[model samples]
Target: MSSTPGLSTTKQFRNLLLSDQLEFICEAHNGLSAKIVQEAGFKGIWASGLSISAQFGVRDNNEASWTQVLETLEFMSDATTIPILLDGDTGYGNFNNMQRLVRKLEQRKIAAVCIEDKLFPKTNSFIKGDAQPMADMHEFCGKIKAGKDAQSDPNFSIIARVESFICGWGLAEALRRAEAYRQAGADGILIHSALAVPDEILAFKQEWGNRCPVVIVPTKYYATPTDVFRQHNFSIVIWANHLLRSSVTAMQKTARTLKEQEHLLSIEDKVAPVSEIFRLQNAAELQEAEDRYLPRGAEDTCAIVLAASRGSELGELTEHQPKTMVKIQGTPILTHIADAYNAVGIKDIVVVRGYKKETVNLPNLTYVDNDEYAETGELASLLKALQSRKGRAQHTIVSYGDVLFNKYIPQSLCQESDDCVIFIDSNWREQSRYSRLGGFAECSIPNSRRAFNAKVYLKQLGNKIPESNTHGVWMGFLKVSPAAATLITTIITELLAQPGNRKATIPQLLQELLKRQQPIRVLYTVGHWLDINNLEDVVQAGEF
Candidate 1:
């Protein structure tokens, strides 16, 4: 439903290098950290080998295998929208290893890799310092050539990372290695230095003659400004290890404070709110998957909305239209309701239609005609729609056509595992039409240990409505689990057979299910709902 253009992150990364502007990339160890880096406004990500190894509480001396690092990079690629440049430490092995690494990285949509010219199972440069062994010139160049040959995308970069300074080999060796790597078809050169300043890195960029793009990892020389890198014509700058390191410090401090105070309330205000965490974790997206793939009769994901009512009480609003067909802000009210469902990834929709059924057409929807709309209630229309899906769908959300609520309501409903779940508005008295409707039925659920995951049992169902002591009013959204489908169908049949309950309502049907001792629960979502009945209700809903 979105019209925004898609971006090839690989091409965009290559373009950033081709452009004159310097690219400042952030480092991440996992998917969530990568997303955090992106959210902080960085242009690209660096999948640091050290950070990934540290994540598993291991040293960064090839302790974590290449496959483990590759898996981490894959998660980063999927989580963040930007390109990732992986720290391919010593290419994991020989030229053969380098070739396989390139192939795997390209498959995961990684934009680039920076392979250091060090022996296999190399130690961390910053820790080992001055004692690390550099790989043979011919051998390292062969590895670079192999990686370049294995690259699947023309834009995929293979940057040769030179550790001459780290190995105590002079600037001359670093420059020589840079030239050899460039000749060996490496897309760029990353000159690494463990010094407290960028003097050696800046000198390398100057002497290298800009033959290829230059990269710098200023971990030790953190104070070097971006303008200095731009002055030396460095193409990319990686602030590697900051995110993982900062996270550790923050977590440690929080843990210590919690231990000292023996409670979390003191730190609650300082920590990230629960809502932000849910948004970052893509809770809504997860619920969409739950709604689509959970099996009911055949497939678990499906829903039905009863839109057959003519809403005769709305005066001219339904003179020749069904209640759902009436427009709110130039869009059909039913479309708005359907949009809420679609937003949460419920695409298999069934709309029960009667009055002006021809005008209720929408894409990707199945329609069931309720010719008895003038003679039946909403429950009858729902029963007609459920016939086609009797024992199949894993879960079904049945909602009234005359109301509107936030997408979160249905998203929460899909995430719940209850056999039968009902939605309620605890603050329904705020509605403008509350007084006019002469108050709805009260269904109170008490707060007791027995009430937790309680089996709701209705005492009776007829002209006398079931009363609940709970604070909320039913909002007409129900989630029916796969195991309850047959029970619901049988109950509908039995209720229809009884003369006194021949025209049973939705609440009445639910009450009958309760009497049968069904496992039922309630979800209370308060302010975000609209139940349009008359013109006054429409005006109030629009204002809301």
Candidate 2:
């Protein structure tokens, strides 16, 4: 995507190499780093061999296989629009290996490769600068020719890295190797050095005299000014390994601080927020793609929140506002639930309001009034919402307004394909404090230690289920398919026909569905939800 409209990535990279002005590139070892490099306004990427090897926890001695390095290059290529020049150490083998490497690089859309004239399993230049031996000149030239012939793209480049200076063979051998590689069809030359100054590079440039484009990696001589490279007319300067090194320093500090403090309080402001990570990962793009390509049913799922009851157990908290309006961390409980629903693409929300109805207003919600609030329970409110909507949604979510849960709960529930699916908190035993709050469930498989993917059906669900018979507690959230929505409307209409059943609850309605063999499935989660029942619950919700 970053490539010029008409030019290919290989051409873009070749242009940088042959440009009249000095060009700069930064190193990136992974997809994320490659994106970061692109974000920082770099024109190209130097996929550093040392950095890539270090990322895999291996020494930069070809310890990571060629295929493994190619896999990383694929990700980097996909993540950014810029050309990548890979540090292909010794072409990973001989002339045949060089040929294969070039074809694979083209497949991954890599722009160029810079292979050192050193033996296979080459040591890092800085590791022991003078100890490593250079490859035979004729054989290395043949490898360069093989790579050049193998490339399918005309602009795909091969920059021969001369190691004569690194091997203490000095400037004469470096120029000789450079000339031979250029004659063998190398697109450019990368004259490598590990000296603390640019004396050798400057001498090589002066004598080489515009024979071809030249590249320099000034890692050791970083203190030298950038203007020097520009003044000397070098083709490109690579700031290799700094990004990886800087990340290492930052991660080390963050890890040590976290281990010592045991909390994120001190370091929260010092690091990138989770939202920043989402932005860098281009999460919004995926959402847009889903909107364009996914089914309408997935996007059109509706939510009906039952918030009609006055939570008397909260004492004075519900005296002025409904329990769902109680603020936790400055956001109302109902707002949190609404946000969760919207996050999972459930935009058409209907809130059934009753107690302190005038105080229950929120943005972007259709309100259905349950005027007989004092005379009824959750079932009556649900009935009001359903009758108002007239069974329009293909899939509908029913939830209690006072419950606060992680967004993943609703995200997971939306993926269920069953006609009726009930969410049960299997960690109910650990959450004994909520046992008295009701909606205990009894499933066909009573044991909580079943296989993770085991199919379990709800046999009974109500406040009256005995503790010994209940497998878990319902989190007051359920999804209903179109058929189940129709079935529920019929059942609720029949039940509410009797005036005395006006005070019925949602759990009781679920019990009736089970008795009629409605085949409701259970979706079990551990603990990631809470309900506000009493004043103690208010305190816990704040912390939740």
The global C-alpha lDDT for each of the candidates, from Candidate 1 onward, is 0.80, 0.89
The TM-score of candidate 2 is: 0.64
For candidate 1, the 10 contiguous residues with the lowest summed lDDT are 432-441
lDDT tens digits, residues 400-435, model 2?
Answer: 888888878777767777888888887777765664
The clash number for model 1 is: 17
Positional deviation of 162 in candidate 1, in angstroms? 0.6
Error of 2 at 134 (Å): 0.6
TM-score each candidate. 0.57, 0.64
Overall local distance difference test of candidate 2:
0.89
Misplaced by over 4 Å in model 2 are 297-302, 305-371, 374-544
